[model samples]
Target chain A: MTPNILEVQNLHFHYPDGSKALQGINMLINENSKVALLGPNGAGKSTLFLHLNALLKPCAGKIRYKGADFEYHKAFLKSLKKRVGIVFQNPDHQIFSASVKQDISFGLFNLGYSATEAGARVEEVGEKLNICELFDKPTHFLSVGQKKMVALAGVVVMQPEILICDEPNAGLDPGNYKILMNSLDTLYREGCTVIISTHDVDFAYSWADTIFILDQGRILKQGTFDQVFKDRRILEQAKLKPPWVFETWEKMIDNGMVSNILPAPRSQEQLYNMMSDRRIMKRTTPKIIEYQNV
Target chain B: MSPNVIRIDHYAYMSPLRNVHPGEKIFFSLSTMLLVLAMDSILISGIVLGVMSLIIVWRAGVKCGYFLKLLAIPLGFLLLGCLAVLFSVSSEGADYDYFIKVGAVFIGVSVDSFWNAVQLFTRSLAAVVCLYMLILTTPINHIICILQRLGVPAIIINLMVLIYNNIFLFVRSADEIYIAQVSRYGYHGWVGQIRSLSLLCSNLLVKSLKASNDAFNGMISRGFDGELKFVDEVFETKAGNIAATVILNCLLITIYLSGRV
Candidate 1:
């Protein structure tokens, strides 16, 4: 079994105004996997993300990192923060430097890297994100999409073991969305644990190996995509629509157009491939025609 | 006005002399400003202004019109201030060489006061020009780097960095709120305009506070302690440029002393 990189046990939290943000939450995030937290607005996704990065302390729970109880000491937090970086939803919130190069290098410098080392890391991340040309540009002068890239590059430069993003695709154009997804994919491929919170069901369905459905500060369901997304009760309770691939696959199966026992398709391409098998279509069309005639 | 400031900052980043060592630029500007302030001669002030203007426009590659526009901003304020030095009013009309008498009052510009006003105007203009040359050619981050090297206290430098970065954030936030209000016809009439403007200001204040909290959390998640460390591009000091800066300062001082004597 893969070791859990992070675990949360009965986490409870409240805002300073006494509003409950998280209530009795328990979760386990495995190492080297793409995890997606899916929920509607005000469903405590962002709160959970903050807890994971140790920005917020749970009032009545414990967090464990690498199978050990997490420590909240300053020195321990510094080490933990170095290993887990977060890219905020709003670029303006995370980017505190007018210079793009300086912003991207901020995390590296905080990690005690020499100036030369930090500069080299900044260059490498800039090249990876294709933002090298924007290094000298003022952060305010950039378009929203460019600012998002810079913010992501700022966290990516740290080379954290776990990279968590809050609403990574929010406000991005389609082209930028694809670029961000591909960048995250590359990071996942390179063995980083990439986690994202999003309301985009299709993106989560297609990308995440594991999905956690959060609703009202509680985990409605948590499992592999096939397990969590297959539960219609949880989806209805969370006010989330099933991914189109799953809906289409279910309709085809109910109509005897495809075998009911086949594995669920997680993407449009996968669904198309399932439907395009000539032998299955040939076998199912006769049964469909007979049923229609009856 | 805010947009114009942003434009100036953009030009600073793109200035041809952006890669020059910031220490050299800071030294040149400060020395020239000191000479203009110390010399107490209109001719020296004029020379310093001319030299700084030439550097900003021709050497730094800032547009001449844009530089003139920037200079015009302070010129208005300086003129208003120089008025106090230029004219005096007195009840008795005997002490002034030049006076306009109205009943028992005299209001005129004396020769001594006239010379002082001229000196003040030129001095202030020269100082403004020197500062502009520095700002137009060097990015604020580079200036911060120079300050850090010059042994400025870390707390002050950190505050400067935060304020410099957040000024843009503040402007952008305020702009967003203004646009949102405008779209909703929040500024339809006098009353609505006041209401909308007030709302925008209050919203900006709240948003800025929230943004600061978020920014601090983000900084902490990246291992930030008390101090802020930023990377700056390496710039080699040029011997020729330094030499030219020294020669120009010496010449300005020489001209100022000669005029004084």
Candidate 2:
């Protein structure tokens, strides 16, 4: 069994403007899992991530990292921050240095690495992110996609155990989107627990092993995609649509076009394969369609 | 394809001397500037301006046209300053090489004052060229690093870095806003332009505040720890760099002693 890398319990938070941002949030994120937080705008996804990274103290509840409660002492917060890196959505906000290499090295230096070691590490991360050519590029001249990659490089070099990204996929073109996803997959395979908050249902459906549906400052449901998404009520309440692949697969199954399957298909290729299973001409169980109705 | 606001910085990053030790560049530029100011020789100042401009265009990869445009920025102010030295008003007009009498006073240019103004103008121009060489060859972070090594306070250095980073962003933002306003005929008339400029300024103030707040949060998320730390760019001092600095300064000293530019 995988260890729970991060746990949030009954967390409550409010903005200084007297608006509730997060309420009674509980979560269990295991090591090496790809988790996606899905919600509409103003649903408190970013607010929740800030809490997870220890950037914000919850108003009513507490968080634990690796089963140890978070202590707000200076040293403890510093250490915790080094291990849990948060990549903000805007690269401009994150990149404070005019030089790309300098910006990327900011985190490594804060972690107390030596000059030679930090330089090598920054170079290595640049190569890993396929931004090697941009090492000496000025941050201001970079395209939005390039800046986003640079921002990701800065945080990823810290080698955080749990990397949280708020809308990492925002503003990326198709080519850069593929590259970013590939890099995230590479990081995940290398034993980093990657978490992202995105408005892309198709991306979350196909990529994440676990999904947390957030709505109105509350978690509507948290489970595997099939368990959480199979229940249409929670998705509707959360103001999200089912991924296109799942939606099509479900409609075909409703028309007696596929067999009863335990786990629903998450991707287009998976749905295609499921369609050609040759045994999929049978009707699905009423348990799913009936449950989806209610 | 980059914006015009960071044109100098763009040249700096792309400079062939970019990877050279900042200490060497800083030392060379500062020494040259001081010599130009102290010698007060028109010939030496001309030599300094010519050599620096040549290096900036040929070695630094900046276009000559842009370099001249940058040099032209202070031409008006320099002329105005030189004007004060060039013209003298006197009741007698005794020492004047040429004089124009206006009412009871004569405004004239004297031979000595003419040489003095020429020297002053050339010296100031040479000093500015020397500084431009430093700016065009070295990125700001390196300058900040040099200051840090020289024991500049952290607060000031941090402020410099933050301001440096945000300057380009705000320039681009203002440019974009200007274009957006122009699209709607915001600057069609003087009154309209004033109104548009006021609106843009107010809008920018709010946006800059938000951007700074967001930047602060971004830094905090990265374990900022009330300090800004970074891995200084790696540069190795070579014998060639040291020798070049020595030879260059020695030649300048030789020219000063010879009283020939």
Candidate 3:
């Protein structure tokens, strides 16, 4: 078995306002897993991410990182925060510095990098994120997409082990969404334990290795994409539909138009091939009076 | 943007005063004020103001008209105080020369006192300009770091942090309040305006208190100890920066001392 990088056992949390945000959540994220904490709105995904970085203290249970208990230890918590850098949903909340370069340096500077080193890191990450041109511009004046990229660079420059993104694609245009996904893929390939909380099921189905459906502060299901997508009932309860390809395949299955012996294709390309095979099969088979009704 | 409210946010680089240590700048302003209070002479204050104004324009890149506009606020208060000083004196042995008398009332003030007022005005203006230059260039976080380096009391430093946080909070709340009020025509008429402003202020105060508490909780959760740790990035005080600061300080002190001679 892979070494568990993060282990949350029976974790429970509630806000001061008495809202239960996380309830008895037991989760183990193995090292280098591109996991998707998939859920609809108010699904406690963000609350879970916050707990991972020790930003929110759980009322019960504990969180352990790499065999070190981090439940109440301040020093360990700070170390864990360094390891698990979270990108908040709204970029405006985190990008408080006057300039993009300064904003990118904020986290690294806090992490004890010398000015020259931090400047180099900021320049490197700024170039990678295409924010070099915005170095001298005031953060508030940047377009929302630019601000979001700058915020992401701020976290990336810190060089965290795990990257948790909360609803990164929510407000972005199509171009920005593609850019964000490619960045995540790059980070994932670099062996970063990536966790993304998103409402986009297709994105999760395409990119995530493991999917966990969170609802009402509890994990409803946890498994591979095929295992999670196979269960249609849980998807209905979580207010999530399967990816478009899955939905199309399911329709063909329900209509008695396709054999149950065929496997469910995971992606659009695979599904297109499956559909073409079915067409070939239909053309070879003689049409009966029942099939002729259509 | 209009000159008044828009002036609050610094626009350009304002690099000349950026490298000066906040503590040193604070001490310099306080010392200048002390000098003005000790010897309120027109010649001394005029020289200080003239020198400071020239430096502010030449080094700091502040426009002359803009600096004059900023000076107008204190100038108004000084005018009121000077008018009171002119009318209230009744001593027969007054050393100053009186210019005019309207029956029993003094119509025109003495030239010496007028010159003294000008001197006081210049000294105060110079000090205020220095402070403005300091804040405009230095980021707020850097200012906090400077204070921490200066060994400011933990409680006072914390208060400054709270003040900085609250300013952003209040700005956010004000924006929301304006949006909500404008939708209802609350800011339209004179009566609506008064009611809206009063309501907005009260709501803002309540929201600010709530936000402060939430922010405190967040800070505590994030291992924010009693003291805030400054980011370890070095602020290079290069040779040029030191030379500029030292030269400015020396010039101001020289002008202040020469007036006594």
Candidate 4:
């Protein structure tokens, strides 16, 4: 496995009102891997993420980024935030500039880049996100999806090592969702570990290679979907419904309709294609080629 | 609520003069406004009004009717002020062009006050349209960019940017709440409308406070370390914008100088 880029070890946090937000949480985020953190509201997802950036100090345990414990000092935090960019769930909150171009350049300017450098970086990210045309537009004039793109571009311009998106696709329409997913895909291709916290099981199943189930201030499970979802009890405890693709994949394996040893399908189309394969390997990895039933 | 409050800002994004440097627009509008005040000539003021109205409608591409409606907003106040200037009291009834029959006083317009009121009215209208010409053509963020470059204090600039960034958001939320209230007949009667408006105002204040806190968190997430740093907007100020400011002001000044105020 690749080296862990971020690790939370028995991290605990509580609000000032004494409400426990995170309780003895442990998790590891490997480098350059797509991770989907699934959780219900008030599950400490936001609190845990805040700890990752040292915005909120963990009450008991420590968070390590690139093997170094996150320091609460100013200098360390500035650098940590520079590397771990967070795309906020609400674009209105994230975007403070009236102009899209200026908003995208905000992070770069904070990092003390020269105006020339910041402008170039902003343009580069805008082009990558296909928001070049929107650069000149006012922030308030943009549609919700377009505003989300601007917010994403603002963080992407920082060129962070890890991009933690809080519900990035929450309010995106179908077209916008595809565009946003494509942008995330491009960022992943460029070696940014893209992590998104989402409630959509099917979306997480299809997209994230690593899945984490977070519940009641603790991480219930963390692994690939195949490893985590194979145990029905854990998912039930987390109150998360299994991704339909995972259910179908399991049913196909149990009925001998597909190779039990084969990998799980990520999408409906992939599952359908698997069912049409002429060669089927049984549970014992039988090397045989025959026309399978349609 | 006038929907135009939000529309006016949004329309600036569609402005044809957007590429023209905001500083130049600021320079042109302010200098011309000052010139109108200094010259106090009806011809120059009239020309400024006509030219600005044309530029806003023709050049900036704001709808003519909408601009006219916006232009009408100040007219009522102008009329009241003009009325105050147009009439005066004299117990001696000295050359009254028109007079009210009051027992011990004559209140009426003299030829001088008439000319004064006309110029005052025309000057005020001209100045307003000039500002509109600036506001409608240049986005507020660009103007804030100019202010930042002009050595404005960072705190004030930050506040301006924040207000510019979120004013429309609050406007939209208020509008949505108003719509939802109207749907439920919460604004059916006059009393109901008053109650609904007050509730909306209180609710908006609370919602805005929450939104602001969240916005601060968002800012913190993006490496905002207390200082509101932003890349200043850079524009390749075309010779055309400079020429327009210099030439148009020169023309207005020439018209002022060549005539008696």
Candidate 5:
């Protein structure tokens, strides 16, 4: 098996207000994988994300990067943060500078890059994200979708190995949603490990290589998308319904419309293809003739 | 957005001179203001005000009506101040050229006091016009960049940046809460309005604190240390523009000095 890029072993965390945010969480995140964390509200997904980024140290247990135990010292943290970049849920919470160019250059500067190098990276990332036009605009006047794009650009400019986003699609309109999803897809294609915590089951089911069902500060189940979604108990415990595509496939199989057993389709296109294949088979099949009718 | 903030920001971002170097604008505004203050001549003050008003309306593309509206904001206070300087209350009217008798007292304006009041009003108005011209042409982001270039301490600069960005956030959150409350009939009456407003203020404060904590965590996750560093776009400084600014200020000063002589 390939070595895990990140490992969480028996991790636990508590808020300053004395609430347990994470409880004995364990997982191995493979490199270059698209991972989705799904849960109801207050399920500690955000808490775990913070721990992954080292913004919050686990009260117990440890986090491992590559094969080594992750250190929490100042020097190590600076390097760790460079490898693990997180975009917060609210753009208002993440964007600090009124100038878009300045905000995008923030992480590069913290990484000790010279101004010229930082400027080049900002331009590159801005073009990749299609936000080069906003470089000179004031962030305050941007719409919510634009601010969200700026916030994502701020972190993407850092070029982290692992990109964790907390609800990247929350509150986005359809057009902005497509833009964000496309951007994440581009990053994933570039061999970046992308982790997203979302409430949209359909999106996770279709997009993720791995799905983690989190409930009440514990990861209820973690496996390949099919393995986790096929388990009714885990879905119930996580307070989530099966993705619509999975549900429709299951119903078709039960009603004998599809006789051949197949794995659940990951997307609407895949499901359509499966159904079309059945229609094509029927069309090419030989038909019986009745001589008495002639 | 509040109408006032929207108006100012709209003009600042859309101004025809927005692409010009901020330093030149700042230099012209500040130097002209200093001349107005030092010379204290009505002629100099009037000329300064007229020039700034013309630039703001014509060159900056701001409407003349809007400029007059902004000017009216401080005119009320100036009039109050000028009235205080013009009117004197005394038991005897011997020292005054004109007086109004109340009962046993006299209140009136003298020629000298009237002249002083006029100069004070115009001077203050001229100073306000200078400041407005600067603000109306240059966005706050450019101003902050200029301040950073001038070596403002990191702590103050960071604070200013955060505050400026969060003002919109706070305003948005506050507006959302206010709308929710109004929908629930929280402001149907006088007492309800007071209660709802107070509740909105407290909720906004809590939200702002939460937002600040989130912002700090986000910063840390991006490798933020004690200092904040950002790249600023290099603005081209034209010698011709600089020379023009200098010549205009010199002309204003020459006019003032010639009048003095």
Candidate 6:
């Protein structure tokens, strides 16, 4: 649908010990959509990511990128990998270069860019990521936030159209997390498809254009935040709570403050404005209506 | 084991030696070791050792005792050198004119052999200390950078990099092992500790393998080709670094030549 950039058809994946990591599943990611893959621990969110870049082979399904089946072709898979860059959860595991500059240039070198082109790309991304100070510094010496930034810069320099990051904000400080989210916004604006697997519900609600709810190796629901998270039963089944803002909106709706919750406000400004509207007199009436049980 | 070892990685500690290229440091070490090995007499070695020690103090600002503790490692050589000179002296070649026995006791030994041993021991010790300062003060990355600039094969440089990385990884593994043992029963006793030790060893091996696999995955994901293309090339060498390195080399050469006697 909507010119899917990534199409997953009835995928199944299993570990060597016969543990299923991804049950029979199907999904499609529209071009330029910033999506979040949300799930609890052991929910196979990471396994789903590995399949995106062809890092983990599918057991019984096909992944097609740009309308080309990538199931059997090695060259296609390699090209797919180049197009879809995955920033791993562990920055330490991902960063193998001696210096920040080298780490960024690593992918470009692999992509067979000329020395001049790779160097230019490295400089550009290093500047964009605010890592100009770290270009010469050793990777090991960098702080966790700096390391993650360096790792992200490394992947970004390759100019991938699709970015799939697994738990990118797992150990981030608020400042670094905001910086990363801002960068993701920037990347989305640049027409890159951004996919983040996260447990940060607020981040997903605020940032993602589409959200995929994963549970027990399956994608149970996929839609805009309002569509996926509006169902409290589904939320409970997935073992996740809706974002605080979403919860507030639901409370306002049950109190007859509004006829319905405005489609999960994507920004604080939008939520603030919608709540403060005087035209909705019902919203102005404090404690006027009984709130509904979820 | 010392906090200083960790602190040594900080820039303030390394600032003095950062100016010298790793190749230059290696060269100085080689020359000093050669001079120590080639010397036949103790007097020349002692003077050479003294000169080297003075240069280390002047350049690196390191203390004599810190280095002496390190030199304590090769003290066996000092003992052996002294013993060899003492026992190998030809009876006919004895320089002492009077074999004086003070009341049926031969108490005094030849001064020549004793001085020779002292010279040999101190000179070799000094050389190692200078090299130690060179390594301890210069960052490993800079050293690798210098080596790359000096036209070393990319493969060799890469191997050195992997080895350096592995040492840190090994340290991390050791730390994890220690924590795991402490968490489970608090490292109680020696014999019972076998379980923890074995677990640590196995876990370390597994982690190393997993790390290598992850490294391979990262390399593949990032488009790592065979040759390591430098992201940031060494554009220029600092004048102060070059000047210091040249002066140190000159001083080392002078000490080495003086040690020939």
Candidate 3 residue pairs in clash (backbone atoms < 3 Å): B42-B115
Comparing 1 with 3 on TM-score, the higher-scoring candidate is: 1
Write one digit per residue (lDDT tens) for candidate 6, span B172-235.
6565445323312223335435644654565566556556666767877898876556544343
**Number of the top-ranking candidate, with TM-score as the measure:** 1
> Which lDDT tens digits does candidate 4 get at residues B136-194?
98888888889989999999988887876677667766765454333222343465557
User: Per-residue CA lDDT of candidate 5, range B9-53, in tens?
Assistant: 778987889988998888889988988899879988998899999
By summed lDDT, which 10 consecutive residues of candidate 3 chain A come out lowest?
A278-287
Model 1: runs farther than 4 Å from truth?
Answer: A282-294, B1-261
Model 3 has a clash total of 1
TM-score of each candidate structure, all chains considered together: 0.54, 0.53, 0.52, 0.52, 0.53, 0.53
TM-score of 6: 0.53
Q: Which lDDT tens digits does candidate 5 get at residues A35-146?
A: 9999999999988997888767899999999977888675676677778888888876666555789767766755667889999999999999999988888866788899
Tens-digit per-residue lDDT, A165-185, candidate 2: 889989999899889889999
**DockQ of candidate 1 relative to the true structure:** 0.01
TM-score of chain B of each: 0.88, 0.89, 0.71, 0.88, 0.83, 0.62
In angstroms, give how far residue A243 of model 5 lies from its true place: 0.5
- Highest lDDT against the true fold, candidate: 5
Candidate 1 docks at the CAPRI level of incorrect
| Chain A TM-score values, per prediction | 0.95, 0.93, 0.90, 0.92, 0.93, 0.92
Give each model's whole-structure lDDT.
Answer: 0.82, 0.82, 0.71, 0.81, 0.83, 0.71
DockQ, candidate 4, vs. native dimer: 0.01
Residue-pair clashes per prediction, in order, are 0, 0, 1, 0, 0, 2
Instruction: Tell me the docking grade of candidate 2.
Output: incorrect
**Residue-level lDDT tens digits of model 3 in B19-38:** 56555554555555555455
Per-candidate DockQ vs. reference: 0.01, 0.01, 0.01, 0.01, 0.01, 0.01
The C-alpha interface RMSD of every prediction is 16.1, 17.4, 16.6, 17.3, 16.9, 16.6
